[model samples]
Target: MGERPEGPGQGGAEDGTAWSGRAGAQAFAAVDAATDRLLGYPFVFRELSRRIGAGEVLVDYGCGPGKVADEAARRLGARVLGVDTSPEMLALARGSATAVAEYHLVENGRASGLADGCADAVMCNHVLASLPAEEAVLEVFTEIRRLLRPDAPFVLLSTDPACSGTEYASLRIGDPGEVYGPGDELTVRLRRTDGSWQEARNHAWPVGVLPALLERAGFRDVVQHRPTVEEALTVADAGFATGRAWSAERARPPLVITTALATPAPLT
Candidate 1:
């Protein structure tokens, strides 16, 4: 995921900047909704809801249009705080507000204004890869740790660096004209429902590198999840049945879902 631009209606990066790009925002907003229905939202949300539980405070870092936050609030009975850098995106999120979810704007590269230890669980969905630098990603992780109580969960979802743009089950890379090398920043074009195209920029980080970064950010017991065909079939909605078949033959997973525990404080 890349940062959104500061100007109005321009899609830029997700590094705590406003996504003012109308087309980008609109495309992503649609993607956010489709993700809930077509992708693995039911499974992911179920896992998150179980881990975070009802009555827990969940901080959705880079919440975009607040789709996940709203869903968590409605389905799992959790209180969700959605933080994003894009005012345009936040505007959309606020427009669809539910009683259990709130939206806030955050500064680029910082999670300031949020109180320490205010969250029981932190989830960064497709947001970490948007960070241009490793330091920025680390800062976000550190901030997540700051916002969480000891041993709280930090869940992350990102594009699998191991899988090529053409290899994913549901996602298709279109008109990019080039393959991304390791750790390269690349622009991805996604086809929209109306036969239009939307673009997003992402950094390619290998799966092996993420756990070390989490550990350095003071998280422990890192675990990775690669949903299998059986798992996908069980949790996927009818609309995503074809995607499960596509995933069955793939050698690498399409998405990387990782979880880590915030390390406990040492007793004085």
Candidate 2:
């Protein structure tokens, strides 16, 4: 769900950061829907839903077409707010608005319009890795921290830093002669629903770096979760297994799902 496909046009903030443009946004919306369906509809969101109770406010950071936001509102009965950088994507999200779900534009991860401590929980799915710089990622984390109440949960789903030479149903990484080390840059090729390919750039930070980053952003009790092959096979739709051979051949897990608690503020 975090993957983006480049198209004819690209747009961004005044700083010239590149987000999906009109054409790219349309393609990305389709890709996101297909990817979610193939992966059984935002498994990470479902997992996060299990942890929070009804009526809690959930913020979907970088919510791309509102798929996860819609699901969160429908299934968990939570009031959901989605924030994204792309106006085109935000339009798509708003087009399918639910009574409990709303979206706003966030330029460079600055949600100035949203009041402080407004979210009970925050979910950022694959957004950090899409950023072009580490500073941007940090800024987004700080923004998420700003939005959450003290001790609220911040759930993140992203590509596994330790993964190398892995192939999923719709993704491929670590080609021959490719190197991915700590802080190195890597490219992921994703298959779109239309049987086309889209490339997304990512940074290869070690698995240890994420928790430290979260701590610096005032998040505590960070816990990392990796999916087992059995879990993946089980959670996937029934059609995941077919005439093709079942192979769990991968150097490491393809995705990293982590939960961190926001550190409570000190009393004045």
The CA lDDT of each predicted structure is 0.62, 0.64
Candidate 2: misplaced stretches above 4 Å?
1-19, 32-43, 97-100, 233-252, 266-268
- So what's the TM-score on candidate 2? 0.82
| Residue-by-residue lDDT tens digits, candidate 1, 1-268 | 1212111123343332334555446556654223324334555575677687778898888777666678768877778888877777777778865643667677765555778788888877767556667787687788778888898888877665455545342244322345554446765444445655445555666667889998988899998876654565567665565543553224544566688889895122
Q: Considering every candidate listed, which one attains the maximal lDDT?
A: 2
lDDT of 1 at 168: 41
* Model 1 TM-score, all chains together: 0.81
